[model samples]
Target chain A: MIELYDYELSSDAYKARLLLALLGVAWTQRYVEYYPRRQHRAPEFLALSPRGELPVIVDDGTIVDDAQNVLVHLASRHDPTGRWYPQNDAGLTSQVSTWLAFAAALTPTASAARLHDGLLYHHIDVDEARRGAHEQLAVLDEHLWFNEDAGWSWLCTVDQPTIADIACFPDVILAEEGGIELRTYPAIRRWTDRVKAIPGFIAMPGIFPA
Target chain B: MHGTSRWFPVIRSEEIVPRHIAFVQLLDEEIVLWRADDGALNAWENRCPHRGIRLSIGTHAGSEIVCRYHGWRFASGSGSCTLIPAHPSQVPPKAARVRSYQIRERYGFAWIALGDVEGEPSLPELDGLPHLTLRSMTFAAAAADVAATLASEPGIVVHDPYRAVWERMGDAAPMLLLLQPESSAMTTLHAVAGNDLTGAGRLAFLRAHNAWCKEIRPRIVSEESRSAQASR
Candidate 1:
């Protein structure tokens, strides 16, 4: 059995939960109170992740701290078809890697803004975070528009969504909590709908199942 | 400002896809537009009555727009509050409703009448010809200034402060330009080209006119700003 050190409201943790659910893998969640109690930064939790991240998954003897790394581990290890990680296709692998890195970039701006507004992290510079989020959203919107024009869906050129879509989904869907509106990015809005319609999809607190 | 009873074009009809929300601003009022699966069109105040969050961020669930904040769902056409996810067993009160505006689809545009309206919305003459609606573009200049600039172009006729008919200098079919006043300093232009041509010809016309609009937008804004500075 896999044990996920999870925080309910954390978008990073939700990414791990989403992929785990989509993979049809049963994992027990070790709840970590991220707010008020701040259990994620406790000494015991810091032992697992030196960076004190809320999501640290321990599967069998292997342990993964970062959310994206956990996703890679699950897909590469468990998915027999190799569709999620697509290790066989070099081009698709590179595209997925690029978007996964993009999702990491989103954590500081989009996720930080969510922490500031939703979780009451008053120390964050919310204006700068929101501005960064909008810039990223514009690039994503343009990319989605071009994809739609070409009759393709998902973040990459593949017919089925890779882990890249899952990596980027949480923050873009919940951006409004951070004072970032998706109204201007109609293409991105449409892409979110496509993401929600995926099979075995589960909704977190902020996201609703389609 | 025109009378509140008049209908204004909020967005193109194709924009309000089924089960998707379209957000547009008209005369300083933000409007949320959606089309139900039953083909009913709805225009509302773009806000959830519960928490005043913009309903444009919400999802369109076939017949209703569900607010993202607290899962409050507003029914299509009526804009009445239907279900509160938190209180599933209890029915909501009659007063729980978002203000809905009268909407009409004419000439490939969604026309919204903000206040009490009388007759049908007046639309530009297309002579019952098949037409193609171009992508709407926004300009930084005021509606009047944009309209004035377009009217000054050769073979262009201004019907009013917000409507104009343009005759291309060559063999292309004439087109109509409708200006939507977004704010004191912004305007949106919607164009309709006559459909006498098809295939590559139609594509050529659309690209040329689209480029023409793009070329004129910055010039109009610059000219208008210069005049405003001189007046000051």
Candidate 2:
């Protein structure tokens, strides 16, 4: 059995949960209390993830700490068709990798704003965080707009969603909690609907199933 | 200065599809724009009357928009509070209704007047031509400044404070530009060209106009900033 260290409201953890749900994989969630208790920083959790992140996953004997790594692991290992990671196609792999890095870039600005607003992390400069998130969202929106113009639905040009979609889904969907409105990014808004409509998709807190 | 009583173009008609909500701003007022299943368009204050959370982030059910924070539902057209899921049987009071603006569809755009208005919004003449709307662009400058920049372009005629017509230059087709005053420092420009040509010609025309708008946007913003600095 796989073990997932998760916090219910953490967008990072939600990414892991969403991918696990989409893959139809059976995994037991080890709930971590992020607020007040700060269980992610506790000694036992630190043993699993030295970086003290929520969403550390243990698949059999292998341990994956980062959310993106966990997504890659699950998709590469469990998916029979090799669709999610798409290692076979070099061009698609490059696109997925590029977006994965973009998704990582989103966490600091978008997810940090969410942490400041929703979790009362007052130390973060929420104004700057929101500005950064909006900048990133504008770029993503333009990309999706052209994608729609070319009749593609997912983040990449391919018809099926890559792990890159799962990587970027949580922060963009929950950006409003951080005072970042998706209204200005209509294409991104429509992309969120497509992500939600994926087979075996599930919603975490603040993200309703569409 | 433009008053809140006058109608402003909020968004293009094609932007707000069924079951989707578009967020719009008019003169510093945040507005939620949505199209109902019945094809009726709605323009309401973007806040849920319950908790002041933005209704723009909420879901658009076929007939109503449901608040994400609390499961409060607001009806389309009327903007009346229809249901509170937690309360179940209890009907919300009349005061729970969200404030709505008068919205009308004209010339392929939704026009919203913040306060009560007496007559229809005046629009430029594009009634007979088959037209294509260019991608709307937002500028970090006042609407008046953006309008001035557009009017200054050679062969362009300003119809009014909010509308302009750019005459054909070279192979480019004649196009209309409409400005929406989002706030004191922000503006959105919507463009439409007569769809006299089809296929590659139309694509090239849209590309050319879109590129031109993108090129001028930064210049307009910088000019506005310079003017502000000079005034100071």
Candidate 3:
């Protein structure tokens, strides 16, 4: 069984919980208080993950830091079909890595805005974060629009969804909490709906269940 | 000027995938558009009557739409409240219903009439010819301003208060522009090409037109601002 350092309201932590549920892998969560308690920065938690991120998975003595790495680790190890990560296909694997990086880029912009608004992290420059988020969202919307034209549903070229979709789902879905409306991005809105309908998918604090 | 009485394009027909709710606005009136499994299209006010929550965020259950809150189910077409999970055995009140609008599907676009509409939607002639729908563009300028600007452009074949038809030169096909007034200060422009395109041809057309639209948007918006400044 994997032990996850989790925070209930943290979107990064929800990424691990979502993949674990989807993979049908039982995991125990060691809850960390991220907001008022600021437990993520605690020395004890920082010892496990050097960056002090909310999601750090310890699976059978092997430790994985960061949400994307945890997703990569779980999918590659547990999924018998290998469809989630698709390590066999080099092109698909490269595309997934690109989107995972994009998801990480969203943290400082979209997720930081959310932290500022909801969690009272007032130090974040919300206007700059919102502008950055919109720029990235426009790129994502165009990509998804072209994907729709190509008869593809998920983010990548493949038919089914991969870990990339899960990685990007949280920030996009919870964007409204940061005062970012999705009305302009019709394709992104539709993609979020598809993400919600995924099998074994669950909603976090601000996201709605399909 | 385009008034509330006229029908306007809300979305492209191909964009409204089944079991998905599309959020659109007409003159600042928010609406939620959804399609049923039986191929019926619905446009209703974007609020759930139970709690005034946005039905746009609700779930589409094939023939019915389920509200995200309180598990209220409203039937298609009629938009009547059919089920309330808290009281499954009892029937919902008569007033428990969603306000629906009159909608029509034509010319690769879904059109809606906001107020009391009497006749068919006024549109340019492209009925029999196969056409391609271009990506819609949203602008900060008013719809009337956008329409007037498009009408003033060269090669205009036909013109109306809210619709414009222009003859394109070279590889680009004839364009049909429809302006939808979302609010006093916001508008969305939808376009359709009067040519049947497929495969690489279609993709090329889409990319070209999309880029061209993006290019013209800033000019239109800035032009509006300049005119407003002049008037002021």
Candidate 4:
């Protein structure tokens, strides 16, 4: 039995659920409350994590901590025809790699952006990161080059939305809140639509409580 | 402690510790790290200056710190106005502030930067490395500087495609670099499971990492040295 531990609104958990929900995988969930502030520090929670991240899952007692790992595990489990992960496709591999990198790599920037949007109008200190994002986005934007023959693929060459799209789109979709306008990039906006059209797709919750 | 221009990295992150109240390292600033006697990481500029508090001395008492001196309590990172002593809120913002760095925890470490940063700092890469217990270190260089150091020499040799790429697919590479500035940086070099990676294969990867470090790093430094010599 697959037992999932989720914290309701966490994107980390969402990545896991998005897959399970689409695959229609039956799993029991245990919701943990972590919002009283600093609750993750509780020994019980820290015990589950050495790095202390969330969206961890247990497959018959084997604990998976990192969210990206969870996604890969899910994709592999459901990869019947090798659609989600095309073994022959480095395009898919490299594409997926970029987003996974963002989710894990750009986290520090995301946390700062949240505060920037919340407390101050200007995000003065993270300019270096903004420039960094621009570089990353440019690369992503270039990869997103869509055409009649090659159009709107979600982080995969299969012409379908794979976990790769699921991974990259969330943070990029919310970039506007951090003063990043996704609308500025045509390919990004188009790719966002493709993800929405996929089955078992759930829209990102609105900011300020939806 | 090197005192090389103490930098209070701006509010570069949002989450510090979900449980323990701890302060992250600021660029070079003398940061006050403490838990509000409660279990929260509350950080401030580690200077008291009034009678010179060294703010770290205070502990959290429900989102407020009781200045060990006479049980004084101040709310917020601004270090302003006491609630316990019921001091007037007009304790001028300047006198009350302990200066706090915005902190966030991701991957496995807590990062705090001083001042208001522009936008957010994203998570770094995690694929390609061994997911063993990660030991990270930061030097006085931006991610871009390091990336430049790495990019100019994209020299990496994989022992086995399965081990380096597929088997350790989820693990980020040994050098997941992002260039941020000229100098001052953060790079997480991870080592994965040693189970399948035997002594020889693992040693090979290590040798590659060391060689990459040795090969590229010195070139830039030498180039800089030559330039400095030429200028002199």
Candidate 4 per-residue C-alpha lDDT over A107-158 given as tens digits, one digit per residue, 9 for 90 to 100:
5554345435644626455565455555565556545642211444565555
lDDT at position B90, candidate 4 = 41
Weakest 10 consecutive residues of candidate 2 chain A by summed lDDT: A142-151
Where in model 2 is the C-alpha error above 4 Å?
A: A32-52, A81-83, A118-128, B1-5, B49-53, B69-72, B81-96, B116-125, B152-157, B196-210, B222-225, B228-232
Q: In candidate 2, what are the lDDT values of residues B1-232, reduced to their tens digit? A: 4767777777778778678778888888899888889998889998999999988778889999999889899998888889999997998889989898899987667899877787996544566766677677777788878888887788889887788888876734567788888888888888877667666766676667768877887668545476787899
Off by over 4 Å in 3: B148-158, B171-173, B222-224, B228-232
- In lDDT terms, how accurate is model 4? 0.51
Better by lDDT, candidate 3 or 2: 3
Pitting candidate 1 against candidate 4, the one with the higher lDDT is: 1
Question: Candidate 3 at A179: error in angstroms?
Answer: 1.2
Q: Candidate 2 lDDT, tens digit per residue, A1-210?
A: 889998889888888888888778899988999997999999988887889987898889789988888888889998887888899889999999888888889888999999998898999999999999988997898778667766788889999999999999999989888998776677888788788878999998888776
Winner by DockQ between candidate 4 and candidate 3: 3
Pick the winner on DockQ between candidates 2 and 4.
Answer: 2
Instruction: For residue A71, give model 1's deviation from the true position in Å.
Output: 2.6
lDDT for A190 in candidate 3 is 93
> B32-127, model 3: which lDDT tens digit per residue?
889999999999999999999999888999999999988899999999999999999999998999999999998888999988888886554676
* Each prediction's DockQ against the real complex: 0.21, 0.42, 0.74, 0.01
lDDT, model 3, position B94: 82
Q: Write the per-residue lDDT of candidate 1 for residues B5-92, one digit (tens) a residue.
A: 7777767786676677788887888888888899999999988999999888688889998998898999987888899989998898
Query: Worst lDDT window (10 residues) for model 3 chain A?
Result: A201-210
Residue B165 alpha-carbon offset, candidate 2, angstroms: 2.3
Ranked by TM-score from best down, the candidates are: 3, 2, 1, 4
